[model samples]
Target: MTRHAELVVPGGRYVLRRARIPGCFLHAPSAFGPADADGSFLVDLLIDNGLVADISAAGASMPADGPAIDLAGRQVWSTLLDVHTHLDKGQVIPRAVPDGTLEGGARATIADRQFWTEEDIAARMRFGLQCAYVHGVSMIRTHLDSHEHLAPRSFQVFRAMRDEWAGRIDLQAVGLAPLAVFRTDWGNRLADLVLQSGGVLGGVTDALGVYEGAGDAEMDRLLDAFLMAAAERGLDVDLHVDQTEALDPFALPRIAAAVLRTKFKGRVLCGHCVSLALQPDDVARETIARSVDAGLDFVTLPTPMIYLQDRKPGRTPRWRGVTLAQELLDAGLKVAIGGDNCRDAWFPFGDHDMVDTLHQSVRIFHLDQPFSRALAMAGPMASDIAGAGRHGRIAVGAPADMILLSARTLNEAMCRPQADRIVLRRGKRVMDPLPDYAELDALAGMPA
Candidate 1:
């Protein structure tokens, strides 16, 4: 397959004939149906230059000008998007592993910050991008810890990499500070820095980041200040909200109310919101409704949230720590999933792979009841929320960045880790190898 794909590399057109794609991701109104039980059907994808030129029914003509790679009824998915991550904190394993608690994670990370030189950040960030690309992720939005002193250096490294990796991986960053930072003058400086760097304005409203806990009224005021700060800058807002099990600090509702009252015209996306699920059914429903009215978007980090939530030293976890994804998705709101933390203080087990993230989420959230819709949570849904253009679909005009799996059905694909899957960036197979862990020894506090 590699040699065949390589033969057509230079200014060529080819037909990936008879490939299976989900009907939900196909663009043509013409319909490919008689879909398989997994909701995918066979289609002929015409790849020209670097775009999916056209998609036709199975019997469509294969252009004589180019070679044909018969997919043999294998499944193909759009190259994934991971809308939430902490690339700046990636790959700090032994030195910073969390003790299976939220505050422990925070303390470990805050302690780890003392050693974060620009060289260290760039190394980890670069390694993370390599893992993401080899795993077929073409776009990522990472949260940079922006607490005054760290903001300049972190964004400096990020700006350099965002340019360096262009045309291979689309990169975006958000400034993540605690919500209280907004009330202080330093928060204004951070927001200004985010604007200058072409990054998003972000903060954590969860119990972990806030200083002395406050009641609903104080929170409403703080939330309003944060929303207005972003509004004043004309920047999009991405927040970590309600990530704790404690129901007292529910910023999901306050964020929605603040957006409405302040008329924050920019896009507002709230991640986590785990406490929403623990709220009374009426309260949760009302919050969801208000969030929808305020046009709030959501990105659920199932893997890391599972690890951080419901943890006890001796007892087994009784509840799955996740957002109300099903209810929120059903309500016409844009709900996406993310790889929140990878090999860092927050969670220790990830390779920057969204396919595995989606697969794990299916088992945890039962997202596979309608397979295509669930798949979109990591693909098109995440891309749409991140404003990464149309790269996440199998439509004619979409970029031909795709992952071709050997398996033909969902069960076959999900049953194992797809270490051998082929990644295509702009119609050609990407041949870059994954980075090795030995490269991070110096930063991870390993002995020689």
Candidate 2:
């Protein structure tokens, strides 16, 4: 069949034989081939007309009809989902590299926003999307800076992109602003704009610039108002909460309380929560339990968390920092890991690669004992959090978009970036190379 194991699909239909897939990525792993040591099982995927026709046990039957890509036990993953990212801020490192701290990053970003004309934002964002797609990421939910003046420009660019990247990469936008804004008349307008653009209602509970600690009655009022705004419009909410090393700014529990008290209907997504790791066990447990009771979803940005949470001039960090992902996952809340920022002031690193994001997450969150569940954070779990379409899992009759890895085991896949990995869309090889950073040279330089 077709030159002995080469990736050549005949007429948009073929069989990917001897393909290894992680158990967690499959909807029905029990019915597949026997599991290997790392929980991956071999199976043959029959792709027809851009959809998975069937997944039979490896070598269950002969493919006497058409081309068969003999993968020879290569690992396969469903195209990934990235629930939290900053596309508006992506690729700005050249102009806005921060001092590698949250405050510095925020200040640098605000300074850079003065130059975010629609053309500049669109070019950088389009570049980010191409990078994500080339690396096999199928769905992305990017949080846009939704200040009154910036919202119009950023949301407009995002709306155009959400339509343009419609089929290739399921793009979702979340209007990200500070919690205090929800109490303003402009906040109502912002919510309306988000609704008009089909975007999520999102805010940072404490932007560090405004510390809304627990027991702050004003914080509660603003939060409840924010939730109500989203609820009335049938919109989902995502918030940046507790993104600091200080123990006082405990906004996550407050968020959970607001959600429960308001009985908000829309799905809630909370990001960062880095300070949760610093809380005492009892406090952390109670907060996590409340989150579960409120049915809240979480996204951890480990890459940015570690870089920003513990940084200081002379002293080394007392403890490694990130959100309590392990505990949240154990509590049965939908916890996902995200590439929070890429080549921006936030982290000044990353290439919009969700696979790399997942790889970083496994180490940062200690999710590799199984690695399958960790993979799901960037895959199915992420899709659920973003409310993006269900391309995150490999299922019967699912789109044939997936990544084929030369590594058969999770360890091998994790050892390196898996640079040799091949991305396939609609069961065919994607030949679009990752975008070069030089393409955005015109958009570089600080505003006068």
Candidate 3:
């Protein structure tokens, strides 16, 4: 047996032997066994042609032509997936000091946008991606600023990065435009840009509440237009809805209603929905039911939401800015938690590590009593929302994108985070250098 710390490359073939993994973490749900005796199993995985060719008992025969790696009973899991992030506006901390309010963060972001050249955005985005990749995230879906003036350039830069980073990390983009823009010719233009780049159509429904005198009629029109455009172009829809803590009319139900009315053919995803936590139980249950009826998916960004919602200067926060994750899960709605912003104007503190996000969410949502639920949020649940089929699970014929951690159990993995983790992308060990933002700054002709 080869006792290598990292799997070797060039050959693109290896047999991971004696790797202990949770039964629930297996790709096939039916394979999950009881948590007592069959909770953790030692298995041998055969990798061939960038896929898991076979898996068997620990002492099974190894691939004749490939080296066998001994995991020594450490835990291994499928690489994480980030369903929602703001890559176009990441890594601008300190440069854009937020005033600890959502509106203030918007102002800071707009002010900083004036200095965003293609080089600057690309460098920052590349750095964020590198951090996420190193931390075992194999797939990410980033929401880009789609203002009329900023989107074209940002999209151009993102497209170049997408092509450049292909095969290493799967990058998906969404054009996050204001809700009102969808009612004008600009909406058509935004749709065209999104179709051109093969990105999802995204709008911020929470901003609709800020529109003076904008009632349900106006909101419905804007959402209908947005969904119609996406349906026409065969694109999916992802919206930032009801991010505020106010009990104002929840847009989640409205969004679901609009999807039903528009007869949309693509998948619909709603992020935030923080207001759901504040709603009365009856109202929240009704809204969740409507959302499930419409086939809508949900992603909760706990970090940024907690940082932005109910935040009044000089006052302690009363509520955690997270969605009703447990309620959604119990209602059988697909819910995933994501690391939304990383060192950006919105939140200003993250390393794009989903494990860290998982840790925080497990506490905030009280998901530790049954650790499997929390684990799914960072792994399988997020992957389901990402729609990047077959990448976030471990099974025969599945893509071998996974992380090897230095923990013996789920509780140990969460309580004691490790830095010496190994990442594999498609059966090959990834050894890319972490991004140096200072060098990127120099390359962009900015001050260190």
Candidate 4:
């Protein structure tokens, strides 16, 4: 079968003709009938005024007043959501190289901060957002480093871009501050900025030991301050927790306990938590139980973790630097996987492609036992965690945010390069030109 070129809907009602979307992909189970002998069912989707108005059996009579594009049995899936990414620091590789350690990456990133003009940050962030949009991602939540000197400028650029891309893609920001700063005037200032820009409060848990040299009592004080501030400001909290291989001084349980004690009403999301994988089975189970009790959500960024964890010069690594995702999911916690960094100083690899992240996650986390569940790590589950509860699902009355794939099966969808895919935002096909690397380089004041 020949792939269908993307149909540009020129802003109005339209009908997707004879599309064969999978039953598993539908939000409503009854939308599609049982598959035929070839494991496929044909349907027609009517999208009107930026919503799915109707879905009927294939060849059903429908209005052809607007335009009708034949899908030719191509599979349709929800566009992806990325809950954890570093847009402020993306696409700055080779220019700012890390020494292949987490500490080294932090140092290198801080050193490169001298060159972070607002224009430079905006250009790099726009480049990453464009890549994500073309790759069929409808929403993203990026973390911006929130030092006292840098955060105001970073938030300024991010807020402007949030408006700039409002219709095409939803952008949410998190102020990635250090926990040690939470009790200081600087922390209050950061909270004010976050509240002004409608962003979440974020911090690094592992940094308590590495950067601040904070012991147990001090860690508790810092965490309490952070949670209290977030509660006072009515903001959600997203934390980078236990991002190291060391099993001792585990911060996940402490964080969960703090959330419960502080009675934080907003959502609490924890990223990384790699040390959970190294814990004894019973201890890990207890930690998961605590997290569930505290109403915590998780996002695992396997690519960066795998790149930075368990690495010593000229030696084979012992463990993959990822969290216990399977355990968390099996325990009924909401776990999502994300593409953490794209071409950044910290582990220089990744495009902002959630499909690629899902494919890799299926391998790294052993998620292919049941294909549908594995796919959810990047789809509906991730969308819900990103606070886009109505997106990443196809149903009557839902926003027409979807992707048309050329593949017939889930395996094909994961394995094949999706070059021929068409992305839709609010029922309209997105046809923005992909950004050129040379152009981005020029914008960043780098040689092409």
lDDT of each: 0.86, 0.85, 0.81, 0.83
**Residue 15 CA displacement from its true place in model 1, Å:** 1.0
Root-mean-square deviation of each candidate, in angstroms? 2.2, 2.2, 2.6, 2.5
Q: What TM-score would every model get versus the actual structure?
A: 0.95, 0.96, 0.92, 0.93
Off by over 4 Å in 4: 6-11, 17-25, 35-42, 57-67, 208-211, 443-448
Clashes of 1: 0
lDDT for position 308 in model 1: 87
Off by over 4 Å in 1: 1-11
Candidate 1 at residue 68, lDDT? Answer: 78
Q: Higher TM-score: candidate 2 or 4?
A: 2
Candidate 2 stretches with Cα past 4 Å from truth are 1-11, 207-209, 212-215, 444-448
Best by lDDT: 1
Residue 166, model 3, lDDT: 86
Off by over 4 Å in 3: 1-12, 29-40, 60-66, 208-210, 443-448
Candidate 3 lDDT over 347-366, as tens digits, reads: 88998998888888888899
Candidate 1's TM-score reads: 0.95
Task: Give the C-alpha lDDT of model 2.
Answer: 0.85
